[model samples]
Target: MTRSAGLSEAAVTSLLAGDSVALEGEHELTHRFTTELLTTHRISDTTYNHALQALGRDEVIDPVHVIAMYAAQAAMLNAFDIPAPETNLPA
Candidate 1:
């Protein structure tokens, strides 16, 4: 899906490897925001202000929406005891 959305292979690999801060293709601010948001459930005021300065309100909102939506989907899957799909990525 990320690839389909225009993420390069290296970027996808970096993201999967948890190198969000120095992603290969993603914008630094966006990836930083994503990492902080996912790990902490909130971004610090510093990060938020930096994101706001680098990306407009809409860009910041978009990632939040995507993260929330994915979290909700995961919760739903867990609630239903659905097995996660296997990935075809390399080991």
Candidate 2:
């Protein structure tokens, strides 16, 4: 699905491998914010402020929505015992 959304195969592989630095463009701040949020389940004031300043209020909301939507989808899949699609990438 992400591939169909226009991300390259390599980008998808990197993301699945947790190598966010390999993702396209200068998204270091975004990666940091995501990492912190996922691991801690809460954003620090400093990180939030930095994101607000660099990404603005509207841009900051996007990651939260993406995370929430994906999490919900994963939960539904797990609840229904639905298997994820097979990938051509290496094991």
TM-score of each: 0.75, 0.69
lDDT (Cα, tens digit) per residue for candidate 2, span 31-59: 78888887898999999999999889988
Which 10 consecutive positions of candidate 2 have the poorest summed lDDT?
Answer: 20-29
* Tens-digit lDDT track of model 1 for 1-91: 7778677777778778867543542366677778788889999999998888777789888989999999899999999999989988777
The top-ranked prediction according to TM-score is: 1
RMSD of each: 2.4, 3.3
Poorly placed runs, candidate 1 (over 4 Å):
4-6, 21-26
Supply candidate 1's per-residue lDDT for 6. Answer: 73
For every model shown, the clashing-pair count is 0, 0
Error of 1 at 74 (Å): 0.8
Q: Which segments of candidate 2 are over 4 A away from where they belong? A: 1-16, 21-26
